[model samples]
Target: MARIITLTVNPAIDKSTTVAGIGPNTKLRCTQPTFDAGGGGINVSRAIKKLGGTSLCSYFSGGPSGAYLKQLLDEKDIEQSITPIKGFTRENLAVTDTSTNQQYRFGMPGPPIQEAEWQNALKQLELQLNKGDYLVASGKLPPNIPDDFYVKISRIAENKEALFILDTSGEALIKAAKSRVYMLKPNLAELGALCGVTSITDLDLKSLAQEFLENNDCQILVVSLGPKGALLVTKNEMVQVPAPVVHQKSTIGAGDSMVAGMVMSLIWGKSLVDMVRYGVACGTAATMHHGTQLCIKEDADKLYEWIKQQAPILETN
Candidate 1:
């Protein structure tokens, strides 16, 4: 089997804590806090591991926090390749209010990357990639990195005959879309940003998704709609996969888990429709857990069956 590889240029230590409730100027007693290695691609790799799959996760790590991130990944038994740099990685905080069941996230900007360090990371990625492998480049581009970084990675994938998957937003996504990619996963907001749409209701989502596939070199476009489910758009067809209704604990890693599920299914040569079905299942399962814990294999299996039973018949325009 071809190995799965995930690249995250900007990574962080995700710390999540729970309190009874949240209010301004209120002294809240936080419950036990949880910390995990995080970034879009890292979360996907973690989710893949939770789903009984293996993946190689590569990212930019720097300073003391980078050491901790590597240690955390090591504890999880997730293989990784780190491109060490000078500045420390950023930390993200997530506060979950138990009383109202609301989750608030505070994210910080990552360290700036030197040109040499950025180029070195790209060289490492190119050297490691092989034919038939799956390469997922996700997350925001840190300052000092070129906007066309993903575009360069896509070209490397093309040269190696690898399957390239992109999960990003704005200019980075637009630039990467110019290359031939195996798949692109974008949340509703990101999709709207890509299509220059201010608001995307259910009515116009399918059309917008089709427009992307037609206009870009993307083979498949996956648009996630949180609890509403997701739409899978290909050149010839489209499918609507509904998320299983569940009491959500936190939605932090849901989208990343969805990408993991989809890529895992694709690596196994599952049909595109089945890939979306399992992706929704994984995403829904992730929301049932608190903190950075991703979708478990058992939950994904159960939800996969449920999603298949409730799958919507999509009408393509």
Candidate 2:
């Protein structure tokens, strides 16, 4: 078993294509579509593989779409464990308008998971996790599942003495943060939501991040700042990782790529500052491509070196 295991409860087959122009009606013909296996944890697994690391991806599945998702992972040589379900997995679409260089994304709500199916997923996770392992539970909970689902997973991780890394939103994220989690990667807006504030200014961001770490069982909080950069906050210190400017292609799977970089860095025993630097590098590299391509190892490595030379850690007071 790989030391890292990822769980994506709401997985999807991501289909992307391009159109010359996107206008209302008038028969807009799209180019040939490309499909990729996606979901928060699955994308993390894919990015890890791209970074020359290995992890087991566990997710729910059913129907032809689910089988296709597994096939996509197999093609990428990513290891996976599937929990069969009754509902077919959902598919999301992304159409890029070539003329305007604008990408329009359409996300679908995943199929509702039955009680037994979700419980079975938990049982599978319990079987896979071990001491000192990293369990990354990401993506949203499917409809009809309880909001406290990740909370239960957190408990399992605690019992196994595994580190739980959570990347999610809304109620699922809110409830799970109260449990024993090792880290959280929330975007600026999601961090604002977690802090119960409608807005978070630059001055208050670090303070709020510090407060969350102090209060919650979560040991590390990484607030992704998109084009600007990311903030890595712990109980002891805070470091701001600046992102290098690059030709933007697509933002899909960027966050998962960032998480993958940081986890791989941790496994390699890099410093926390270097971990966030590599994470920002992977995320920026992911945007230098289209669709769900994620980060390439060469690009990420170059960016990591560039960031290290130009960006320095600012020790927060």
Candidate 3:
């Protein structure tokens, strides 16, 4: 089996709960909260585990919260490789308003990482990544972490002949897009940023994707279209896999789950079309649950079958 390795630079202890209502200046009674390991790559690893696949979850950790994050992943039976750091891990909160069934999420900025700490993380990647391995790096760069952090990781993956799959945003994402990668999962806004534009109209989406591919060393581009599903583009193929709509409880972790699904499909020796279709299934399945539960194997399996029954919308440039 090909190795799957996920790296989350800004891991968090995600706490979620439900409240009767939401208002300012009033004490609201909330239900007991649930805590889980979080961040982009970590969620991907958890989703893979949920789908009965294995991946090595790697990240920087420190302080009590970091220990708790490790404990949570352990409870889930997900393997981990952690690098010690001085800064404490961050925690995020999600509150569901039971009255309106709406979720309010509060995200915190991650602690600053020292130069040595981040460099050590890169060193660890160099040591752990093996050829043909899939290196999935996601999430934002923590405070003080360089914008080109993923770009550095891309170098290591290239030297090791590992496949680098990136899902991130902002300056870090812009910098990494300049390097070679096996795949990139960026939403519409991030794609626009990569194209040096403020927005991407659907009219020229394929053309822009083609232009990006032509200029970069990236092998695959998966642009997420939220509820409409995702567009998969490569040098030879272009496809739009429609997502199966579901009663969405929360959309948290959907993108990470999608990445996990696509990578797992590749590991299973499935075709690229199946990879994106399964990815869409997993992404949609994630919305069916609340509080970062990610996608269940059964739900994704059913959704994948449904997606296959419908023809994929194709595009040409």
Candidate 4:
């Protein structure tokens, strides 16, 4: 089995709860909060496990909150590697309004990472990665970390001859796009940014995606389209994978679930067409749960079967 490793530079302890109503200057009663270990790569690792796969989750740890995050992952039986830091980890809150069925999230800026801390993380990741491994680096950069941090990680992946999968945004995404990346899972907005355009229409999407793969060092581009599903673009093929409609309870962790699905498909040596289809299934399945529960294997399997029956929108542009 090929070793899979996920790197989350900024991980968090997520607290989720539901309230009857949300209004200013009102004392609304909230249900008991539930906690989960969260971050882009962390959630991907969790989703992979839920789908009956294993991955090594490596992240920066500090203070009590960081310890709690590790404990949460430990309870789930997910293997992990911890890099100690001086600053405490962050916490995020998700509150769902029962009145409007809308969720409000409050995110905290993680502790400022010291120069040594960030560099140490890179060294640790380099040591853990091996040839033919999959190195997944996701989530936002913490305070004080340079925007080119992921670009450096891309170099490390290259040195190890590992496949680098990046899911991030803003300058970080743009900087890393210049490096040799095996895969990128970006939403339409992120894709537009990569193309140096403010907007993208349905007609221009295929051309732009093809242009990205042609111009950049990325091998695969998966542009997520929310409820519409995702567009998978490669050098030789381009297709739009449609998503199945489901009762949406929350949108959190959907993208991570999708990445997990696609990576697992690659591990299984599935075709790119089927990989994107399964990815769409996992993302759609994630919406069927409340809070950050993510996708269940049974739901993903059923949705994947349905998606397999649909003809993908092939683009030859």
lDDT: which candidate is best? 3
| TM-scores of all predicted structures | 0.97, 0.98, 0.98, 0.98
Tens digit of per-residue lDDT, candidate 3, span 204-258: 8889998999999999999999899999999999999999889999999999999
The local lDDT score (0 to 100) that residue 25 gets in candidate 4 is: 98
lDDT scores of the candidates, listed in order: 0.90, 0.93, 0.94, 0.93
Per-residue lDDT, model 2, residue 153, is 98
Distance from true location, Cα of 59 in model 3, Å: 0.4
List the candidate 2 regions with Cα displacement exceeding 4 Å: none
1 against 3, candidate with superior TM-score: 3
Q: Report the lDDT tens digits of candidate 4 across residue range 1-317.
A: 68889999889999999998898997888999999999999999999999999999999989999989989999999999988999999999999999999999999989999999999989889888999999998898989899999999999999989999999998999999999999999999999999999989898988898998989999999999999999999998889998988889999999999999999999999999899998999999999999999889999999999998898788664
Model 4 misplacement above 4 A:
none
Candidate 4 root-mean-square deviation in Å: 0.9
What does the lDDT read for residue 222 in candidate 2? 93
- Residue 180 in model 2: lDDT: 91
**lDDT per residue as tens, model 1, 1-317:** 69899999999999999989888897989988899999999999999999888999999999889999999999999999999889899899999888988898998889999998989988998899999999998799988899999999999999999999989987898778888898999999989888888889988888889988889888888899899888889998888888888988989889999999999898778898899999999999999998989898899999999988874777665
Clashes of each: 0, 0, 0, 0
The list of candidate 1 runs beyond 4 A from truth reads: none
